[model samples]
Target chain A: MAAIPRLTSRLRIAVTAPATVWLRGAAQSHTWNRLSGGGDRPRHLDLATLARLRLIPLVGFVVAALAVPVTASATTIYAASSLSKVVPSIAPGNTYSFAGSDTLAFQIENGAPADVFLSAAPLYAERLHSKGLCSTPVVFALNTLTFVTPASNPAGITRVQQLDRPGGYRLAVGGKHVPLGIYTRTLLGKLGLGRALTKNTVSSYQKASDVTSVIALGSADAGVVYTTDWYANTTKLLAIPVPASAQPLIRYEACVVMRPGSDTTAANAVIARLSSLAGRQALFNAHFGLPPKT
Target chain B: MTFRTGLFLGGLVVTLVLTFLFLLTPIAALLLQVPPRDLPGLLRDTAVSSALIVSLKTNLIANVLFLSIGTPAAYLIALGRFRGRPVLLTLIELPLVLPPAVAGIALLTAFGAFGLFGSTLAGLGIVLPFTQAAVVVAVTFVAAPFYLRAAISAFAALDRTQLDAARDLGASEAMVFRRIALPLAADALRAGWAMAFARGIGEFGATLLFAGSVARLTETLPLAVYAQLDVNLDSAVAVGLLLLAISGGVLLVAKLPPLWSSAAPSSTAGGW
Candidate 1:
């Protein structure tokens, strides 16, 4: 019975206490400042006055953005997200924007500022070429799709056939139009397990890296990703080589983007390095397959 | 008009118009790309229809969960004069500042198959990540705080004297809450829920990271837009417009008065 009054008092103070505490803290700080011989000055902004003042920075940002192209020197390379790990190592000095190849192609078509376009699949590069957004696609490297499971093998998957076994396991793949996604579906279709595999797919990521992450995190029982992706995450993933009969010939294509104000000379040089002996060796070391001889 | 005064007014109007245009241009672009005449055909695509169903179902479940669980928690924080109350509020509001990507990874580390309680959850025959349930959890983590913060403010703003009088009349805490606090805070609570629902329906990064985007399973509207981007630009634009319309409708409906309340003449103002 006596607890009710205590509770009521506490409730009454609870809502208003923070304001008083803040005021008391401010007062104590002011006293300390005076004792230390510091000059008095209010430390808070007058928000009403700031309403107009804020536009100065906004205008400055607009001006700076407009002025950037005049002095921009670094070559901007738009590469597929799959090349994110290897591209910088191959060529260390350029600005790179890594995303889905299809997305990069679409952006180049829609006028994104890119000097070079490197894609995991020839399809996106061909699309850009047809649109006159880039040079003719060049097959610089090749990759093959492989099955990867979490190191723990949570679903106890040992072979590809179990992917469609009874009491199905979760599988993560790339999105429908993603190069890896297209290749995975093609591989499954060739193996005559397409229907069953589609049923087992739980997530389709836009980035191949995301598919690897999901598998590595044990969020999915298994996933299909590039041979290079599997090698990059070797510690977290156990790879199951795709059967040769169904393995798709995954090609890495590159071309110089034809946007206005782009550094085409530098972009072409970047492409040259990718197809050069050192670049092919670097890709080989990273487990990417070399393109067939012309 | 004085030159300086006229200049200030003109500058203010220009700023307002610029801000409005900045906000509206993207919406206008979406409308132009995917006009109303093409919506029905876009909806016929199984991926778009499945994504819409998944979004509505998951967000609905998430909002209901928020109302049931969040309201009581807010009341406790507002009224409980406990130690660490400020800390508690900060923890509740932390998700508001956390990038949705960070929230996704946090969820993964805490609840994923190999997370902190991985074996414990596995023992219980539960796998949270990569499912519709995971979608619900992702949205709840990021969106619940919006409702909780609003609810705390509303409950704290209640008339303490009326509450005290009710207690003096021998009303139990539950009775006082149901009879007084709940009714008074109803409007703000609805608005908070609507905001949360809007945020949940459009949740992308976290859901993509935590739940995985499988059409008809875990893909919400935003994920659908991303997925469609690579497939068909027009389809992606159509889905984005649908999401915008749904959010707009939620805000509109939440702002309007309840039909029953509006239908009845207010006794407080009646002299007829």
Candidate 2:
């Protein structure tokens, strides 16, 4: 009889402890709910709390109805390394853009998202087209290669053939892979001046801008850069003619990257602008030559 | 015990794993990508050889200049009781706060063709821009502060009593500095040297602006890596891997001496 009373007392203590805990939890939750703005609580409570819940799915449905997928409206253009000096002035609305033809090609090959590509050379554009990474490319502008000298013209390098003079003056050229550099080498080779020029060429830079900076800074006696670049830096540099045998006509090309099921209207509009009179004027203003009549 | 705690822990672990994945995987991939056969040919390239030699020579010169000049300057800023000490310290550390590009511009404004010293230098027939000398100047500008800051803290932590004691024993001030101060500050000096060397090696923006990238002349390893990337992607990767390997070796050499000493516990059994 004594053992039964002891057991009953222990049971009563356990039951009362749980009741106190439940009351405390309820008061705390109510205070929190009042402090906050009575935000919605989870409806799917455990079996112990199911009797006090209300069901509502309309709020979630309303939020779902209001949501819309966002798509990028701006076009990103990746331009060639040499065009960096001039392309920014022509981009529509100055949307997100990156410059560097080789870098851009690498980026595209690595699947970087870009809408359009403008190359300093047709070969790169053709390569991208053949790889199915870009649509058919069109030649957009023509450029003439010119030998640039510092304003002082210490070496008096008036013509391209002087690039081969013995004990020749130090010259800066673009890296072998850059389009302008490759073209320059081809022209030098055609004139039988490649070997002699190579001996005097002190360094090769990766960009035309680098070559221009060198010439402007008087680090080199002369360098080859675009006519546009020469005009842009007229005060610091003077352009001397590359002999007809040593100059190559350079052409620039642009292409739109085809995206599956996406509207090509904006891209086609940009292409149209390239062919328009105002666009040609913009090119002329940038010191680039007009596209050869055809 | 609750689901929220479990979710939080899971999220923390995921973040940590992702950080490791993003930062370390590329380096790991580089090591894996380099074939053993190509290493010899890649290292033998005249440009690569020249770049490596230039990097070492320039960094050594930079380190020496940094220590010789920066140590005393740092000590003065750290320990001197002057009205403008805080301001002076801030001025000394200004380069640390400036972006590398801004540092380049700052250097140019002071030393370029249209700069304060430019016309005078031109009169003397001293061209400081776009030359090997310019490379040294640019590296010094960027890397000196790393040594200076380390040295300042090291000097500040030194016990003044040791120096006073040396002086009281009739030792010359130079002797005290050489024997007492330098020995005690050896570790800090080593750390400073490491920082200066690393900074010199990694210096790009200031170098590009001041020295200009001229292959085999002004081009250091980083510039070489950039130049190679333009001509040959494989060669670029090879250079990058070489840089990575050298950096790894430096870190290992810095740490392994201590690890080896600890590992050979028996070697220290007779130590006083």
Candidate 3:
């Protein structure tokens, strides 16, 4: 019974005793400061006063935002998220500001500036071209999907059909807007395993690059990713060939987005270079696979 | 009115009205777009209900985990001579200012398969990413800071006189905290919890990066919103409405603190 009071005292002191301690410490510091003629100031802002004062600047910012029109002067290149890694290498030291496909379209739709649009699928380029957002779409390279698993192969997945076998193992794929997701669905449908397979899917990321990372990270048992991604990361592991019969040939397409003071000649030079031997070499080097025989 | 006064009023009106519109228009548009006939059907859909259940469960777990650790840490900092306070606070609040994508990447680096302890975890047969558990962890990482920041300020603002009085009366420190300090700070802590809960419910970027948004599995409402936007608009609208309502409700509760429960010095005279 005596021990209980002691325990409670310790607990309470541990929690609430600090307030008094801090206050005493602060008071002592002030006394010492006065005795030594040292001056100090409070650091924290009075938040209530700040709230009222900040409104002035907030209004000013609104006025300024309306008055000033900001635009990038450099030639803008809109690329898919997957290019985040490979684009730097593709156009080493190229003078261009990159944007994501969604933001690019939104900006271009709202009359922002751009020079080139590289889409994961030809559909986006064609859509933009139809709306006069860009030039005609040109297919650049083909990508095939592959299934990647950790070296340990924890899911005991030896065959593609075993994926739908209802265990707790998580399967990762690309999101619906992603090219990989569409292809994965199409291929699964062809194999008559679409809905069943989806039931087991635990993650659908925005890009094939993200899927590769998830799989590589070992959070996912298996992932559907681009051939190039497999090549880039699968140095030790061979891609479980996603049977050619079931594979949907993925394409990367590009078109020059129209801009104010748009340089058709310079833009075409870049486009021509992408199809050029050096560009094709870069694409092949990345293992994006050559464009299928037209 | 004078010319300067009129101009000031006009600017103030513009600022306040524009700010309100900027914040509300998008959410209001979503709320208005909820087709009356489809509202029931959308809510009934497995995708909607499942995602809602998953979001609530995961966010609750995140909130609980945060408070469990955050409250004690706040207590330690608020009392006595706090050492390394700024460094400790910065570490705790890193996720607050971090972009969701960076937060996700950071989580991946620490907990993902190829992460810092990835191999060891793998050897131990433990993988966290792309799981429901991973979603809770991500939300907790992003949401805990809200509660911590609020609690810190609340504890800082507490009156030392009352605490000293309680101690002078021969009350144990535990009794003083239980009867005085805890009640005094309850209102602020409640608001902090609401903020944390709201933030956790709406967490997307980091959760997506760290946990992977899979429908009917790991996907939360935000993920469901993206998924439905990819396939169907009605589903997205319904799920979006649910998120807006929950987020709004949390803010409402935080703002209207006195209505629900009394934080009126209830513990001052109570025997602990």
Candidate 4:
């Protein structure tokens, strides 16, 4: 820790030396006379002087940046993209990074500084748990795949049957490895429309939120997204119902990641909040299903 | 060496070495993740091959377009003495600084389905958002500024007296430009194009947002890395390494002395 300040100061001195030498060269140049002052001394500085002046603030910024301390007490929660809105709202103070569940898991496996891990599916949580990167998974909330179209309904897509035909309309789906995509593909297969709809897919985003955005922006005629995501964007999108029988099991799981130097108590509190009754109410308000009875 | 000179040189070398280590660590880590024997199998994935082909094809066409149009634009701005030239220069360089996400959204609002000219494009039966052309447009929009900025600097650095002497010798303005300006600026222009091409090759956010990440259709190498992340982590790492290699190759080719030295008036000219 003591060496850090010394190292940064050394770096600062090293960077500053060249700029000073270059500035002196510029001040002596003939172009400096023509450009600014015609040999007038005051306000006669060249581009290098101005550049060096700019460097003062930048140097201060780097020093200030190095001086600032990292807040180890603040927890960082790595959650799935589907929980982008709700998780932050529920756990407002801590840092949050939302993406595909698998991507978050991959990041955790590779040593991200995540205090808590919230996955949109059990598979990722289980994988992390098995690897001893996280605690045993606990189901927190549930979601189901549904078709969503832009409010403008560009292709006039209303019924689920419209998606069963290839080239019927431009579709956005999640990537094959992402939980949303896996659930979407499973549901489509259950409905016997996987192959055809796969043909129609124009984009397969790794993040579930991207699917919603594409449809909401009217870039794609429709896309598959979680019921919660559709509910969150009710104004921009209209939803098409999925047959109950065709709905794949969509669960969100949370676990405390075993990262070194993290606030485990704070991490545990976040997981507890998600599994609590208030958490269930928040999830319900956002249209997420409660975990079915054991 | 004098004490002051020695101190300055020591500081400079320290900074240089620090910067090199900072930049090279990530590359070294990326290389370590993928074993050499796994390269062929990773490249064999049809999706990987498709991404490579798409990136190369779109980047090639985009580079050609950049050289043709960007060179002239840079020349005009650097020497035209026209009104609003600063504004034009600023606009050209704007995309270079704009966030990639912002660039993507801007492109969508200008050329998207519901954008200003969306209906006009639709009237022409043209849909661009999910097509390969959209990928090219995204790359062109984000990458053109690199070449343009470099080209402008190259042109601006040329000696004005030589141009005037050519005109005094009864050479046409166009002839002077073709013979004097182009040759003098060739090395810098090549370097700039390499930068733009490299940027285009690595462009992901804008292309994904504008063109949509369709396999083999709109997916570039960076997009392939992203798309394959969880489908196969090894494949993702392999694709990332490929992009790094390609970008490094571009920089290397741009630096090769013999290819650029032919046009130089002095050995040190265009050394950058």
Per-residue lDDT of B56-169 in model 4, one digit per residue for the tens? 999888888888998887898898888997788888888999899788888888888877888899999999888889889999999999999999999999888877877777
- TM-scores for every predicted model: 0.86, 0.77, 0.78, 0.88
Query: In candidate 3, what are the lDDT values of residues A1-294, reduced to their tens digit?
Result: 344334444344443354334333443453334533545554342222333233333434457778897654554566776665666566555455444354455566667666777777776778789998789888887778787786567666777777666654687787766567777888777767676454675578765666877677667788677777777786533466566888886888888877667766666777777777788888878777667534
| Ranking of all candidate structures by their TM-score, best first | 4, 1, 3, 2
Q: Residue B38 in candidate 2 has what lDDT?
A: 82
How many collisions per candidate?
0, 2, 5, 0
If you assessed candidate 1 against the hidden native complex, which CAPRI class would it receive? acceptable
Query: What's the i-RMS of each model?
Result: 9.3, 6.7, 10.8, 5.2
Interface root-mean-square deviation of model 2 in angstroms is: 6.7
Show model 3 residue runs off by greater than 4 Å.
A1-66, A85-113, A129-135, A151-164, A188-201, A235-238, A258-269, A292-294, B1-14, B28-44, B113-127, B233-238, B270-272
Better of 1 and 3 by TM-score: 1
Which digits, one per residue and each the tens of the lDDT, describe model 2 over residues B47-69? 99898887777777776788888
Model 1: how far is B248 from its true place, Å?
Answer: 0.7
Residue B95 displacement (Å), model 4: 0.9
lDDT of 3 at A278: 80
The sequence of per-residue lDDT tens digits that candidate 1 reaches over residues B20-134 is 9999998898899977999889878888888889999998899889999999999989988999999999999999898998888888989999999878988998888878999
Pairs that collide in candidate 3 are: A12-B173, A12-B174, A13-B173, A18-B80, A217-B113
User: DockQ of candidates 1 onward, in order?
Assistant: 0.37, 0.19, 0.31, 0.35
Candidate 1, chain A: TM-score against the reference? 0.78
Structure candidate 1, residue pairs in collision:
none
